[model samples]
Target: MVYQLIKLLPIKHLPTLLGIAAVLTSALVAPSAQAQTKTHEGWYQVEMIVVARKDDTGQEHWPSNIKLRYPGDWVELKDPNATEVPNTTNNSASATATAPVVDLTKEAFYLLPASERQLNTQAQKLQRNPRFEVLFHNAWRQVITNKKESKAILINGGQTFGQHQALEGSIRLSVATYLELQTNLWLAQFDVNVGQEITQTWPEIPLRPNYTAATINNLSLDSEVEAELEQALANENPQWSNGNFDANAAAPEANNYVTRQIILLQQERDMRTSEVHYIDHPALNVIIQVTPYPSVATTPLPTAQ
Candidate 1:
């Protein structure tokens, strides 16, 4: 068959034909120049599922000595049900701010409905199995930026006891050459035993690790002074990064969780669009997908007659 096919085409022209085919294939598979430049700049819709294993008979051993605590800076996920608070100033004594406004990135970070989740089928399959019990699942949208600019979104679910939830921590999504996911979450069974102290304690840290404290508070300092202050703070506290709100618990809050045992799930992963990624533990498991979503639609031109 190979000999017959080669005979149909002139041997002298085979090199040119192959070269043309290669160029056409590259055009179809490779991304355009514009797309290559903006891979990490645009908005992305993220969906995830968290499930616990009912049976870990054959699972690998996990370390129990490792300590787990919440990160200092984590932003609360924007609630879809809640209205946006406008940053309005009173123009007159009698007038009040009417409308709320924010940048496109912040506006796009709203949580999506469960119906919009792409992993509904996957969740269902896990639910049907006897070895797995679905714990929590949700979907949201945001503008994913580089590692230096990305914010850690606070995540909490499962049974609520007093002021703490069974599952709590933060998920930070960043793009440093590639999409990176960092999860610093912990699962605990809590009780209402008041005054009971736990070993875990959260250190008071800045809300925005990427920004300076003065910037977060809107305090303007001399460039040299700010730089010196940041360096001093960094030297004092290793966790300090020239690093949001009451709901975010970004500043400081009461910790009322009473748990004898806490299981920590800390892992970092590199992911690609349109593919499902899974992070597994002996007691907990996570399934997630991050897809690029455009705020505006693109329509192709009509074909020529």
Candidate 2:
């Protein structure tokens, strides 16, 4: 009777038995609760293309169009139509030549008249403009958190305290030096030369060690950090030849450097105090109240009854 019952049981039950055995095996192979986060899992690739320019004060202007892509995230490239050329390294004859940085290696320096004219034409267009422009659009902006709004005051006339007063509104004052293209054009030249070196070094510094994006103000810092950065940049990209780049150049060059340093210092300070979002956004643009102090009116009102 037992042999007859076994024969009646279907042979297909063997596969079902194997499936149950596999489930039990997997259950036994599961991991424990002691695992930690791995660094390889944390590494995210982000890219920014910086186009450097000089301001009136000869400070470096790093305007970039950045794009970032993560395995699970989406990124919108600033220039969707921008061309992509694959780098080839296999053949010596076909090896691509690195284009020399024309802006830096160009024979004539900023002091030359032709360089001044080129910079002035561009600087004038940037100044007195209050529009917001996008630098990069990606999930990175959500991560890095740089300030999008400008903090610097924009000079505009408004009525306050029963008289006309200068209102302090916000504008896209060059993150670079403020140069009047006409009389003080040389100031712009000085910024270009020195700024080039500074911008290059800025990326080298691990601005954020912990993550792909970091807030510089949040970290504990030395008082000399600003001065050190400025000096390092000056030494790397000297304005003039000889052992004395500062001494050889005119007073305006030094002045421009000093002023630009001040602006940069202020920017650093603002990054700490103000709501700065550093992600992919390039320009510092924010709307601030230009509260004009009440103007003092000499015109006396008739005696009140």
Candidate 3:
């Protein structure tokens, strides 16, 4: 009946009716297509790799200045293997199923799995390179907030040195008009010449402000602190040696000069989401990428009555 009515209409009117049909078709399809595209605003998956170059000749010599400290507001990445806590609700569950309770106590921030890491190929290349030493590699997911609300994440790896680390510090991420990454990392070198003899390598590192912990200005790496720490180690473990440390093993001499020789890698970089960024230094290098995390509907645990 509608086809018979259209056949009776004038040819000029048919063009206008056909145009209206096309407009209606486009209106129906446009919204669905737009909804399918993911929007990135809040959370992101961040991956980072820190590497030290063995070929850098300048690192072999003691630096003219030294100080090392961590940022005051730094946070350790949540270990997923340690515990299972719910961070999302079961909104996607069927209407027939009981509504799962959302835990208010569970933190919104946590580390994702190693399988979620997208930079395994880059890490493998660095590990395989003879000139490079892979110090720290981590991938975690967290909310990216503005500078005022953003907190720094601790970056630590490599060998241990009496409550300290061979590589220890923090990297911070914040978004203003753009996403930015700030690195305040240090690589601690043991004295190959410590307890041997006061040679030219034993250049005294003067008192310097540990400005690496940008949030804390009062931080200082004093010579007195080093001397006292050395004396304590001397009293506790005479067997303590440089480079290689065995807590049980006895040392041949009193290694009193064991402290941090700070080789810092500090930089501020503005980044775009999903693009890999490289921050390089003479002593160390960092590779990082931040990608938007898709909003996922996770099944929540059933609430107890």
Candidate 4:
């Protein structure tokens, strides 16, 4: 009956009827298409490695390794209370499932095609015009001890020390977009000490972009307190070097360092999948890769036998 009604319609009216029919068809098909295009959101495995060089002529070295999982909920919520747990999965088995690890020792890592054009472009710009060098220089001077006078000797024709040490580390972040995954940002920390042998120094390096000199200055007090605690522990327990001292006495210093590091890490910006970013430093190189976690298949429960 509907076909007969349409067949009896005038030729001019048929075009209008067809247009309405087309609209109805599109309205019916739109939802299914939208449903088929799933929004890709999930936890991503983030791996970062800290590579360093002692000096300009020294070979590269890897001093630190970090692995963590970034949950989709945390990224979406952007809440400070959200906790990021560690990811224990070994990512080597499935190539398609996760981002490949960047080995800094190998030359191929730097040669890999950049996942995002903007990231590549920004990195080049930063390399060409580094505004943070002055900040780095000041931070290095504050942390590194200068022993130029201690080693000088006028009686022996003014002998001096020529040894120096350099430290560098960077953080790379990748994120996924609507069309593809790419690197978003890079944060780097670097330090160098030029003098005779001195005590090991823990440089107050910022892992986040907003980390400021004032915050580092405040954190310096913690180091002094830590040193006092260690000295007290050593003096009170002569056998501390032989492992006879109370471990409880060292808790405060350890806790202080860990807490501060956690705060710095928490301040870092979030990243997504396939984004490749690097923070460049004279002494340190950090590369971070972000990739989606592989989906696990759920097994169906068997019916009662």
Model-by-model lDDT, in order? 0.57, 0.22, 0.57, 0.28
Where is model 4 more than 4 Å wrong at Cα? 1-43, 52-232, 236-244, 248-277, 294-305
Task: Look at candidate 1 and tell me the lDDT of residue 213.
Answer: 27
Cα error, candidate 1, residue 26 (Å): 30
Model 1 bad stretches (over 4 Å) = 1-39, 57-64, 84-106, 191-258, 296-305
Q: Mind giving the per-residue lDDT tens digits that candidate 3 earns over 106-194?
A: 33345555677877766776677677778887787667777766777777787533344567788889887568899888776654224
Lowest summed lDDT over 10 consecutive residues: which window, candidate 4? 136-145
Give the count of colliding residue pairs in each prediction.
2, 18, 2, 10
lDDT of 4 by residue, 1-305 (tens): 22443586666445433432242232212111222232244333433332322232132232334332222211111111232343446555453333444322221112222342223332333234322111111000000012211111000001011110122222222222321222221222222121224333333332322222221222221344434444555665687745454543333322222111100122233333344433333333333444444424132211111
- Tens digits of per-residue lDDT, candidate 2, 1-305, equal 22232355456333322322232232222233343232111111121111111212232353222221121111121221232354464567776644323221121111122331212322233232223221111111111111232122112221111111112111121111111000000000113233434532221111111122222332221324323334554666675324333322222222233111211111221111111112111122211111111223232211211
Question: Which candidate has the highest TM-score of all?
Answer: 3
Residue 73 displacement (Å), model 1: 3.5
lDDT of 1 by residue, 1-305 (tens): 22232355565434333332232232212222232322466678898887766554224333456655545545565556555554357666676545534333345556677788887876777677676667778887777778776777777776543345567778889886668899988766543334555555433221223222221343233444334434443554566653511122222112333444566788898766655666645567777888888755232211111
Q: Please, what is the TM-score per model? A: 0.55, 0.16, 0.58, 0.24
Error of 2 at 295 (Å): 51
